[model samples]
Target: MSPAQAMERSYATLKQMLREGAFAPGTRLEAIRLADELGVSMTPVRDVLHRLAGERLVEANSREGFHVPRFTEAMLRDLYEWNSALLIMAARTKRPGEEEKPIAPLWEVPAGADRIAALFARIAAAAPNHEIGDAIAAANDRLHPFRIVEQRILERVEGELEQLITRGSDQPHAIRRYHLRRMRAVPDLLRERGEA
Candidate 1:
């Protein structure tokens, strides 16, 4: 395989392991072992490890090599705070008046709401029996993609809003208002999901 393909495969495997709790926080990831398991060369595995380190998913230890980053309660709280803010921003950009709508129904199934619900259920069930750090890490793994998608949507909306504002259009404000409503509902959704 090409170096890029190898790197991608290695990263994917590592990421899966992290998400599944196969590699718990602070667990050292040996390059040779990972390469052998993934059927890739050390070069690609090393590159993937470096990339993961940059993303804060893995930490580079001078003496022990790369290990999964450990999470603190404060760190988890901060992550949730950031995630909530970003979701609000994204929702606001999509349809500004979404806040006025009752948030409870917004989290109903056949939508991203179900995914959130499932994630929280997983977290809740795991939290009591497992380490808090592990639960938080798993939650982060699940929530990260949703945040990424939200950011992408927010970026697109911002681009359009910019152009509309330049044209002195009133539609941008209305759109933003709707999005704010939707964004405001996010916390409620999270709460519901967490409780489920």
Candidate 2:
């Protein structure tokens, strides 16, 4: 593979690991180690780390290198709120002169963290503006770890997500409730993850 291909591969691999809770919060990411693991050079690994940092999926420090973000309750709450608002805004938006269509009711869209994120992205894509979709994606990347933990802690997560997907723009209240439920569970989530 070419140098750019190597970097892109490294980026995708590391990003998936970070998003899937492969690293514990605040765990330092040593580029050399990752480079060895990914069979790439240190340069590409370092570059990938910086890229993930830009997405807020990883944190970078001059002295300490890169590490997973240690999410605080407030940060988690804000992300949840931001995600909720984005979905709600998307629900209320319409493509100019485009006829309204129900959100594709793909009820078999898997389950757990990926399910929720995928469903939300689908909702965001309904908006007239592309920026909303991009913003929601960023939020989803940052929130993915939390959602993984939440799947284990929260009750009836799949049911809530199904409601959100099935009702789509017809029930903005469902979107709010879905996020609010996670927001309220932040304490328990943090405690469960030993971050509280």
Candidate 3:
């Protein structure tokens, strides 16, 4: 394969490993060993590693090369908070009479619902093994629509959330808490529908 293809493949492999917890957080990626394992040259592996570092999926250390980025509990909480705000923004934008309505309720009515249900089924069927890890990795790859919906919502409420965050508004914590509660309900919902 070409260097570019090699790099892309290596990057994808590393991403999957990270998502599946194979490359656990804080574990350094040994370039030569990784290259050998992936059957790619070190150059392409280096390129992919550098790219992941830039994306904050990996961290660069002068002494030890690159490692998966680690998140503290507080950092994880903040990430969830930010995500909750974004999700709310998305749901609101998709709601009727919302500005422009990037995602029409009608679109999510039939096909979207089916698609989401299928995803839930897959999630439910994932076993606690390598197969489950693969499924989770694949699920991350298929999150574009969900991410787009989130981005659309965030775009609308960006200014407000930014202002609040900048002004040290405590509302994000509350919003975050609300989202956590709602997220907890998801598993139950899926179970009720016999999807889980």
Candidate 4:
């Protein structure tokens, strides 16, 4: 395959491994070893590590190599708070007197983070401002990794999302509460494993 394809392959493989918790947080990654593990050369692994560094998922230093940053309790809570604010902003940006599209009832919706994300995406898209929708979409992608770890939180959020979508209401408190609740569990899990 071409060099670009090799890089893409390495990037995807490494991203999946990281998301699946293959390496504990705070572990330093070696490009040569990773290349051997992924059946690629060091070139693609280096490129992929730099890309992951850009996403803040991994840290890179020219002299010291790559390190996976640990997610702190405060850091997780802050991310949730910021995401909650973005969701509220998306709601507030809606034009006045705009009629909301009908949404499915709570019982009809499926459980899972993807569903919860779709619900938020729909709510954000309802805003007349295109920028609001795009911002929400980007944040949702960044927050995707947390979904599997926080299934309980997502389950609670589904009902709140339904209320927001159907009634055209801004339920920032509900969103923030849902996030903070999940924040409690993540820190414990990460800390117990010495990953935080």
Better of 1 and 4 by lDDT: 4
Kindly give the stretch of ten consecutive residues in candidate 4 with the minimal lDDT sum: 98-107
Tell me, by TM-score, which candidate is best.
2
Model 4 alpha-carbon miss at residue 81, Å: 1.3
Candidate 4 lDDT over 90-187, as tens digits, reads 66676665454455553355666567777778668767878777777756654556764565333455465555554444465556666666666767
Candidate 2 versus the native: TM-score? Answer: 0.92
Report the lDDT of model 2 for residue 70.
86
* Cα lDDT, model 4, residue 34: 97
Which residues of candidate 2, in runs, are more than 4 Å off?
96-105, 166-169
lDDT (Cα) of model 4:
0.70
Pairs clashing in candidate 4?
A: none
Q: What is the TM-score of each candidate against the true structure?
A: 0.52, 0.92, 0.52, 0.71
- Candidate 2 local lDDT, 1-196, one digit each (tens): 7889999999999999988888888899999999999998999989899988898888999998898888789988999999999989987784553235554554566678888887888777778899999999999998888888998898788788657854534557889889899899999988876677
Candidate 3 local Cα displacement, residue 150, angstroms: 21
Task: Candidate 3: list runs displaced more than 4 Å.
Answer: 95-178, 181-196
lDDT tens per residue, model 3, 129-191: 344334333433333223223433333323333222221234335445544643444444333
Q: What's the lDDT for candidate 2? A: 0.84
